[model samples]
Target: MKDGKRFPVVEENYRFECTLCGNCCTGDQRVWLNPADLMRMALFLGYGHTSELFRQNVVLLDEGENGAWRPRILFKSYKKLRFCPFLENHLDDRGRITGLCRLHPKYKPLICRLAPLGRVWDAETGSEQWLFVKPAPDCPGVNSSRLNSLRETLQQYGSEIEEETAFLKKLQHFLEMKSEPEAYQELFYFIVKRKGEGDKR
Candidate 1:
């Protein structure tokens, strides 16, 4: 049952928990970094600015409307399997993954804090919404205190959540309009024109 305070508790029984399995941090998961995340990562790495770090490590995935570009950092891999560049699989003398991140805790991205949670937009209203997902089937924290922790983390980054929601809405709108090229071109022009007007202010 949802605490019924922060997020709308859906039919699915939700809980908070992380087993430190590191499964969520690895693989082809779309790890999109935002401006705030870039700043945090740079500060953590003792770099004066994120520009240098971004220029060297990030690759542009796609171009969005108004010249916005989506970039992702490449991960280092030993063999065919790719891991999160910030993840360290080694254990201490006690043999624990320890949930330690190579990037400073402050620098971790919005997605990092909101793991097991996803954002979507309602087609009818064009409003954004959030949904929680189980990190893994084997995760013991599926319906426990871990859920609460995740919610708290999300609350702390409320602004980022809203921004993400807006981005999702725009992306969805773009995709839906793509099927109608003429309509899409018109809409794109309208948005660009409005953005240009806003920049003048």
Candidate 2:
């Protein structure tokens, strides 16, 4: 999708409360992670280092040549349903809906925290625009009135958004370089590389 694509915001505000339906967390999409996400999850899980999650299958390693590697939250499945490894059926138990994110509140990936709302960073404009991607197959939470607290929800993750935006800015700069061999490892680590946990959902 193009950046700044217009989306219908309800009553002049975005309306979306993740019902923990797990639809956003599932499907063929992978939950890409950044160093900030890894550090949060690691600390939350009581791991001294981020690498520890790699060994436990909590996070998957995408090692580019050398020691250059990035971490991703590998997808896991229950029966035939696929989702982020950290998503669990907790908060609610209705229909196909599950509970909540295991790493929520703080360690949740930025992507998950900003569900329903999509964002694209425009380097040319030097700004990031929030958007609403086409809704998932049929997610009820997207239009739920409970999604009224856009500012408050975002406020809770102010530091995280800053960290994410800063990380993206750096990555964008490195990607623009003719060749990033000198900073190849660091650049690769900063980029959110995708690694499929499986072929099926």
Candidate 3:
């Protein structure tokens, strides 16, 4: 459960496919980057270290336990609107301007890859609860008639989702063991290595 409510997994009654309207890429939504996200994005961008990516494009928020660093993608302002830095616009076949993700095909942040789906971690149970978060009032993706089963859609990125979740669990464990904010902060800000957390994959 998140925000005091349990989100049910997507059901057969629901249908969704991104229309590329770019609505989900904008507004006040936050594109949180987990450790895996930081690592992959840095590698994709040819950065030598996750800290370098943080220095250039990502912002570490002081929103985690004991103010442990939480990484988030930086937004770019265009035409008085704020959007993900990776958001790009192009003319569709009908000449309408539509949005595209620059990191797509590979390297999109897990949150962006989830699209119409969402998941919440229940630490007490150490399990994930999946749910629908799209067909958002402003998004037309849910109206698409050509849609895949929720199971299939999710399976397409199952491995990646699991890997990120594992890393998150590790992070939570670290926070619980470390009492000093600075101790955890360096793990994200300056260190390119994962300490004793295993390979940097």
State every prediction's TM-score relative to the real structure: 0.61, 0.69, 0.79
lDDT (tens digit, per residue) of candidate 2 on 25-113? 67766566777887777768876655667778887755432233445687887798777777676534344547577787766778767
User: What lDDT score is found at residue 155 in candidate 1?
Assistant: 72
Better of 1 and 3 by TM-score: 3
Local accuracy of candidate 3 as per-residue lDDT tens digits, 164-186: 77767766776677655455555
Q: How far is candidate 3 from the true structure (C-alpha RMSD, Å)?
A: 4.8
Tell me the tens digit of each residue's lDDT in model 1 across 39-92.
566556665545555456642244444333444556666777676778766676
List lDDT for all candidates, in order: 0.56, 0.63, 0.70
C-alpha lDDT (0 to 100) for residue 148 of candidate 3: 66
Winning model by lDDT: 3
lDDT of 1 at 97: 69
Which pairs clash in the backbone of model 2? 16-147, 89-99, 90-99, 91-99
Instruction: For candidate 2, report its TM-score.
Output: 0.69
Kindly report which residue pairs in candidate 1 clash with one another. 15-143, 16-146, 16-147, 17-141, 17-146
